[model samples]
Target: MTFNPYLAGLKTNAAEPGKGSSGNIERPQAVGNIPWQTRPAELTAFEMTLADALQAMFRDGVETLPDIVARLNASTVQHPEGSWTEQNYQSLMNRLAAGASV
Candidate 1:
């Protein structure tokens, strides 16, 4: 089995409703048996890229907790196919405060 980005995107959105769709209904899907714990670096880099892209997209310069959270939320909404959630955003903010990247 192999990883299908389309199916993964669908699964991500399915895990949480109201996030919208990925528009891959007719695409042939691939299945995979990869372990979640085996992808830390990949996941982290992906998240970092997503956060950076989101920041670039809405760059007014973050100055406060509320502002950061709002921007994160907007980014999550914008990229509904990614693994962004309220908890993940909070964790990212905590990591940032602790001098770490997403």
Candidate 2:
């Protein structure tokens, strides 16, 4: 959260700084962050980049997690963090499903 210069002063409108800091921690979307660990990143970019590929595969009638995993592993898609495993892919899907808008 400290990395975002834009969000430098975007703290809760606390009655007092020290006291307000005691509230439950919250964070904006952790999507396509550039200077990592900060404000809401460009989630749409992240989504569309991956979604486009997935959509194409689905349109081609690809189904099942195993198949998807195999295709992703074999495809030319390059995840910023590296290769995809079944577990990591499933976890990512879960994160996307949680609240990621189209």
Candidate 3:
């Protein structure tokens, strides 16, 4: 399992959309060139963790599969087998894309 810093303040099962402790703030619209994408109906725990890590990495200018794998390994996150390799990382990506948690 990975320890993602990004997930620290997020609840696994969050409140209904637009509801929050601060009281129903409006959700922001897509800005600039960022296109709005449809949300997945649900995600597994592993998907959530991976999404968090990937978002953080992208914000930090981390791109490319090899680099992503390296950063993931260096962080608290590890692939299911233990550590990450490019091949395994791609394999996992494929499985996840196919809607498989493993």
Looking at candidate 2, the ten consecutive residues that score lowest on lDDT are 24-33
Candidate-wise lDDT, in order: 0.50, 0.62, 0.66
Candidate 2: C-alpha RMSD to true structure equals 9.7
Q: Give the clashing pairs for model 1.
A: none
**Tens-digit lDDT track for model 3 on 1-102?**
223322344553244454333555545452122222222234667777888998999999999988999999998776888898999988988876664555
TM-score of every model versus the real structure = 0.30, 0.49, 0.57
Identify the leading candidate in terms of lDDT: 3
Q: Model 1 RMSD to the real structure?
A: 15.4
In model 3, the runs with Cα more than 4 Å from the true position are 1-41
Residue 31 in candidate 3, Cα distance off native in Å: 28
Candidate 2 residue pairs that clash:
none
TM accuracy, model 2: 0.49
Q: What lDDT is reached at residue 34 by model 1?
A: 43
Best by TM-score: 3
Question: How displaced is residue 47 in candidate 3, in Å?
Answer: 1.4
lDDT of 2 by residue, 1-102 (tens): 323443445555354333224563333342333364443334566566787879988998888888887787777775556887778787777866564333
- Model 1 regions more than 4 Å off: 1-43, 54-59, 77-90, 95-102
Of the two candidates 1 and 3, the one with more favorable TM-score, higher being better, is 3
